[model samples]
Target: MEWGPTGAAAVPADYAVVVDVLSFTTTLSVALERGIEVFPFRWRDARAAEHAMRHGATLAVGRFEAMSRGDARHVSLSPASLSEVEGIQRLVLPSPNGSTIAFALADSGAQVVGACLRNAGAVARWLAPRVADGASVVVVPAGERWHDDTLRPAVEDLWGAGAVLDALLDALGGEDEVTSPEARMAVAAWRAARLPDDLLRCAGGVELTDVGFVADVEIAAQHDVSEVVPVLVGESFRDATEVQPAAPKLRRVDG
Candidate 1:
């Protein structure tokens, strides 16, 4: 919306969909699918460890640090690392972009949901009826950061946000009234862009691949393939797709 979590908070919506397809939310999507509860953190500090300990959960390590230490068994943030892990009931994932927005929205009076290309359709389908029933929704693209720790508007996130928005707009059927210009532009970007190939060439994708985490990008690139919709429940994200009433599925716009 405006800029940071502050701008996002300014907007009044029934739901805020936070997307970080590069890693955070993608791993979240995968973890939820595997039935693991996720707690999002903004910083990788001692607080994360303490929170994890307090919850009796496992603290996630940075992807680079995990790889450096050859720690594949308990890898915290990688979708590829999920296969190597076992018995992980809860996870505290630290991400500067997506996690910060999601955690900040915990008390924003609106429901918070984690999104990526993977679960955009499911999230859209879940929101469509509520929206038709007069519930508002806002899609937040958690852009990447710059070297100086500034926000870098990552296209991968735009695509991820757009993926959710495009489907939402399609499901609502009244794009003129139910959508904003920015939402229309996001849908345009999603429609015009070659998502799968462009994601592999995008900055976020290349960054992951450059560090040997190409699998993360590949996982993030999958479009609407996942059905797990992770909603922020209290301090952590839990899958909500199970308890939701069956609604009309989004008509997938395949290219």
Candidate 2:
């Protein structure tokens, strides 16, 4: 899995998975757990805010730089804040990487899923069945950009992808069973697992921890904490376990 530069580019897989562990995706998961109705705004903040107010939702805004006002009362999807909320109606989120990639993949022929370190293992288990069915999966890490420079392209997502790949490999076995180049790429990326700590200390991970979302950081870093895999349908995330697990190979591993 890799994070690609944003724009209206073609999505490269039969199934596309987006990872924004630092905030956007994490916040989306947190909001859903809190019973907030999440409506993805794509890249339009003004439109998202308008929709929230129109729906009688108390708007909570989040951005790439810092936590927004009212954000403290809600679960911050980003690494900078871990505040929890009971229920949120709408979340106005803007991330340096997540939102852009998500929106791009939204209309891709591929099935899009929201992934994070928190749900890595579950995701792997879930994908097993799909792979068995001949589905191609692409894991996209939302990459970090600093002052026009994209630094550490696959650090965070690679770790998460590696965990998922390891699980899939353990379950499915052998290169012949794997068909997606993205999946193969993910396995290659995991080669860095030999120095797991250094990989975690990369740019995106450091920023996430510095922002006080260390729990999220640690949770995402850990392999396979939950057997629950979250999938994006329309605009809402649903637990994959609620449905039958895909029948590919099931490999168990710690993230």
Candidate 3:
């Protein structure tokens, strides 16, 4: 299934991929690759700190705050910032769209993973074996916010989700076994929008560039550059590669 941030509750798949290309999931992919456990939060608030403490995680500050430090050790939502840092045991990553959608999905009992253009192929390959034959895999794009606080579907996110969908479909052989129309369209859109150059010209990319986050946009646009698949487990995201394989479910004997 494919939907914007607002349709998070509508996801019905047991395995889910959340794509937020502008920053959230992209930063998360970078952070996870560095061995830091990321705890997603819906907002940067008092509750965010509380949630972080409960999970033994440190609350990430705003980008400005993170950038001001001489050593730049803080973890913020910026993918560029997270890419250079290391040795953080836990971090609370807050985002209005991506983290909110992730929080919602966590409550719905799906095994959630963050995906971006950087790691779509790796995530697809990682998830393919876990998906039961014929089971659905939902892809939720964390779009930007409109003036009225509604979801404004973002081109970058669409491409990011598409990259993951395209890889997963290829992994599964074809879309013949899948059911979502949005998923098909997402893959087509991704195919139409080539990486790097196309992404740099997109609306989201333009916005980021204007705001002086050109590096973040550049980093987010890199396709299949990362192999780390960040899976949400318990209260934080750990490297899916390090997670122990799930034990097979045993059938109960009939009385």
TM-score of 3: 0.91
Q: How do the residues 1-255 of candidate 1 rate in per-residue lDDT, one tens digit apiece?
A: 333465577775777788888778899999888888999998889999999999988888877778788755557588878746778889899888889999898877778888899999998998788777767777888887778987778887777888888888788774765467777787788887786789889887887789788888888889988998898877889899554522322323223
| Candidate order by decreasing lDDT | 3, 1, 2
Q: Between the candidate structures 1 and 3, which one is better when assessed by lDDT?
A: 3
Whole-model lDDT, candidate 2? 0.58
CA displacement after TM-score superposition, residue 171 of candidate 2 (Å): 2.4
Flag the better candidate by TM-score, 1 or 2.
1
Off by over 4 Å in 2: 5-11, 33-37, 54-58, 63-75, 79-83, 89-92, 149-152, 177-182, 194-200, 211-216, 241-255
Which stretches of candidate 1 lie above 4 Å from their native place?
1-4, 242-255
lDDT of 2 at 134: 66
Error of 1 at 88 (Å): 0.5
lDDT against the true structure, each candidate: 0.81, 0.58, 0.82
**Which stretches in model 3 have alpha-carbon errors above 4 Å?**
245-255
